[model samples]
Target: MPKNALGAAGPAVLALVLGLWGITREDSMWRDEAATWMAAGRSPAGLRHLLDHADVVHGCYYLLMHGLFEVFGPGLVTLRLPSVLATACAAAATAATGRRLAGPWAGLLAGTAFVLMPSTQRYAQEGRSYALVVAAVAVATWLLVTLAQDRPAARAATWRWVGYAGAMLVAALLNWFSLLALLAHAVTVLRAGRLGAGRLPRHWATAAAVVVTGALPLVLVSRAQARQVAWIPPLTWATAPAPLCLLGTGLLCGLLLRRRPGAPARTAAPAVSVVWAGLPLLAVPVLALLAASLIKPLYIDRYVLYANVGLGLLLGAALAVVVRSWRPFTALFLAASAALLPLHLGLRTPQSRVDDVLAPADAVARVSRAGDGVLFIPSLRRDTAEVSPQLFAGLDDVALVRSPADSGTLRGVEAAPARIREAMLAERRILVVGDPEDHPGGPGDATKRRVLAAFFVRCADAETRGRRVQVYERGTSCSSTPARRL
Candidate 1:
């Protein structure tokens, strides 16, 4: 009700969010987190080399976290804190914008939703760019609204344009996926008079420049990336459902809230905001389905968290609109969120699919020696093996040794099969964990059988919650070559 109370509560909500996200997630970092940690180690120059050449992640977020870790303590907390803070900042920004659009009460409501919304809370805990990207997109939208408010005096208008342009630039730097946010913004504003006439033309010109600058790196990298184009099929529709759900629900809620009576704004402005936030989340799935029809490989959900923010904010707003004076509504929201606390603290948190070992990982962690090198043989199942780094922490090295070339330290990428054989040549003791994919036991599948056979004379099998672990010792009986025993 009061300005003082809203301002005070903003940080409190943010603190509650950060507390939930940060303190408990220290036990396990998911696959994408591992990927970020792995990427954070690259020299800034090395990252530039990777980015100037290979830009799927768009290079900027990794490089920023790389610097943050240098200052923060190079631990899980350090890797994750920036993102946690970013999510909070995004929530705070959403509140500020809500305050601008509606009033302090509305701002507080929206901000609270941004922080406490389950999906937002879940991602804020992760060591990835989604949280930071969420914040940036929020800030960019806020700035867009500021521009649309149109303080036409030269200085204010110029400043609004500057803030708008700068926020767009930073958002692009954070996540290329935010490109969808930018496209959505451009579309909504244009449809309204927000970007109409001379203003619209200039805005388009500036936006075109911003997009070109942002996409230049991607276009260049995508060229040489033809070698990896085979992996692009994962972008298809059959596999696109998760992202669609992520973005669509968020957009739907935001639109629903933004359009409600007493929503404290004209329909057109909030409509534009909803459209801005929703389009990319909406389009990527469509594109993925198209790609899936054409090819068939590469789809995932975590990054879709960026699209979820608008939804979360809108959902919060919708809840506020409906339950304005209802204690039960507030209690229901708080109670449902609070109930997730135990899972959040436990290693069993749902994101563990990306963060830790399911059953098989626990099996290996339990039975295998720290010195045992575990290989998820089929390799490249990033989520399934998401728990590997955490399980092997200070214990063993895990790799996708699809081949011999992966022996020694090749980071986490799959190594050539021959290189692995050569690297393990001298080890008097070796343990190989085989993947089921390598042994489908089908026609003309002797090569797969031979690889498995060569690695084991004895198969020691173990089982954990969701996975099966089988250990193999070298044996001559299964191979014509009579491989040496350890």
Candidate 2:
């Protein structure tokens, strides 16, 4: 294979292997992915209603997944395969961009490093829009590099700009956080302008404007649903370490360049371009979000996952500097893989996520009897049963007023507190599905627990995979009714 092909194909193939290794996580699905599965299974009207009410930012991704589910049917593979393919494409784009700015060796290494990163492996198997957003941004970044270096005139340049804009628009539609990539690209374009790439910066501005304009409506609508991000914690010393570690590693790799980024020497120009491109992409988006988070607390490492491509490029460039021989490079890569083996293995397990959304079903099956009333504290735990409705088949959902699809919401709408109390009182036996014992549930959950405690006594309790299933019998005292086996 040609060096360019090797650079692009090697990392892509590796990404696929890693992504597919445990794509199903032994047939487990977490809550976030459960959200995707439920949304994708909805009818067009239901999906439109969902957008009107919540998750408008994920509207495009949900629709795309809906199409895939329509054809493939909603299995774990169908739900997660697109993310794997998107991650592979992102690895290819990252390699191509590094190759354009540095060389084939650097590009290949960068791509390899990206595939090995834990974040890439984690999201590559998730059924979400983040991986797709990364792919779009990586492709757009590669196109920007081509335009800067080739400096193609007239039609060719126009076509590249068009591709760039389209790629960026797709990313923005998938997740508006991806728009941060343009900030990194703008720095790259300014560097190109400094290097006498006339008209390129102006062309980039036009392409960026088009992308922003196209995604403006989504931006406005998603903003209206701002409560969707209400769970994101405020930035503080606790949240500072992760991004700092990532940015610190990138800086360390950059030091390996051992040259001024603005060097004007003909042979050193590529190195300068690589540094300018990779460093900004590595630093800017993360820093911008961190600064913004100080005001509103929106910083999440996953939100800026595309920045890992920049780190990969820098690591590749640094590795290329020392590992002139393929044998040494292979040895070093193998050593790094060995060090990450445990983490990679962990990513494929059901325990990797916060909670296995399907795990509660087994416990529910064990404790529930025909006609028993089921109630989910905090409501969203309804996802646990939704993904495995068969196990919950005989149980009555006592508080649900409307299904998620019927309500146009992620979680089904529940009855008012008074109505919920009235409904629960009618049941002789009720099953309480809740988060882990340590979880401090919201006021609504507290109210539900208080109501349950007033009339029902716990007969049995079981916790598995981050969920708690408690069997309750009517009567404040459990002394009369024997405690049931778990």
Using TM-score as the measure, which candidate wins?
2
* lDDT value, residue 65 of candidate 2: 95
Question: Tens-digit lDDT track for model 2 on 338-401?
Answer: 9998999999998999888887888888767899999897799999877888999978999899
Task: List pairs with backbone clashes in candidate 2.
Answer: none
lDDT of 1 at 369: 63
Error of 2 at 155 (Å): 1.5
Alpha-carbon shift of residue 249 in model 1 (angstroms): 5.1
Candidate 2's TM-score: 0.94
lDDT of 1 by residue, 1-486 (tens): 547456436744664555454444535555556557655766776666555434444467778878887777567678777767777777777776665555555567767766765666667777777777777777776766655554356677666666766665676666554565665565546654544433743664586476658666765656575454453444545665765675567656656655663345322333334334334434543444345445545344444455554554455556656667575787887787688677555433544443243445555566556565555544433333443447655433333443211221113355455545544443323344334334452222333235556655544654333233565555544223233322
